[model samples]
Target: MFTPVTIETCITFHGHVCGGISLGYVLANYAMDKLGAQRGDDLYARMECQNCLVDGVQCVTGCTTGKRNLEIIPGGPMALTLVRRDTGKGVRAVISVDMPHGLSKEEAKNHILSLDPAAICTFEEATLELPN
Candidate 1:
């Protein structure tokens, strides 16, 4: 379970709390739950954007850039796919929530946290993609 304390740790590691991280946190936890993933497991994450979301996933799942298990591919919509390298099973999450433009960062974060992760994003089964 990625609890509020985990979000606090992610915020400290990320330098601030924002909507992106909160969404990422929710999505990451949802995906992890779907895949039965635990922190420090042989997990691989493919992120579809370059932003705060990456930090949330990294902190929550213990998959890091240095570990070469987190890949950030820019130019796509905000999405994340997490796979267990051992079984090639994974889940893809694409954000579906829409926040108004005028909300403050805290408001945005809280708005994201208040909803169910499935309400904030859509999830589907996926297979790991790796280049030879």
Candidate 2:
């Protein structure tokens, strides 16, 4: 049996806390709650982005490359789709916050390290079709 995952563990597993990590945490929880799906068993998360967000999803949702449930489509913006196998329900979300702008590299770094990661991003949610 798989132990339930926590946000704290996800933060640790993803190496550093950031907007992407929080996005993953929220996305996974949202799917589990809305779709009545467990993270480890029937829920598969497919994300488009080759970045930190994928790591966060992998860590928190028990979905990863090894499980054949996580797919990373590179060269795309940050977005995710959570699909529940048993019910064929899914949720699609895209980050509502625009990418950071006008900040120096140092400022960007500081912003990433100091700001509330969860506050930096919000998702636009909608129903979606789950892949067969």
Candidate 3:
């Protein structure tokens, strides 16, 4: 029997990259509420750029006012990962719900169509571990 695998979508926001962590938190909260995820539950994951440089030089960065790895204001990068609890059904539900929030259905369909055909896979099939 073929077991259904959980599907997760990773959204990458490219820009100045600064304040990405804060933005990621805000977006995650919005997504969780929009997706009806429980509070204190791990609905999504965020990754912040630690050390990045601009113009071949290191500078302070980030949304919070303080010294950071880089000096660029928007040099930070943010990544949001949405994971489905159930394998098949949850994936479909999440996609159906979040597609409209970020990108329109038509745009999402087109984007998916533009992707490499072989890139489709399951999130549960891969083991992801966060650093302590």
Output the number of the TM-score-best candidate: 1
Return the top candidate by lDDT. 1
**Local distance difference test scores for all models:** 0.81, 0.64, 0.27
In terms of lDDT, model 1 sits at 0.81
The Cα error of candidate 3 at residue 65, in Å, is 25
Cα lDDT for residue 112, candidate 1: 82
Task: Please provide TM-scores, in order, for all candidate models, with all chains considered together.
Answer: 0.90, 0.67, 0.26
- Tens-digit per-residue lDDT, 56-106, candidate 3: 111111212132221122433432233333321111111111122465544
Count the clashes in each prediction.
Answer: 0, 0, 10
TM-score pick, better of 2 and 3:
2
lDDT of 1 by residue, 1-132 (tens): 434337778788889878878877887888888888888677899999888888888888777899888899987777889998888888998887664367887888888888878777888999877533
- Greater-lDDT candidate between 1 and 3: 1
Residue 101 lDDT in model 3?
40
RMSD of 2: 4.5
- lDDT at 41 for candidate 1? 77
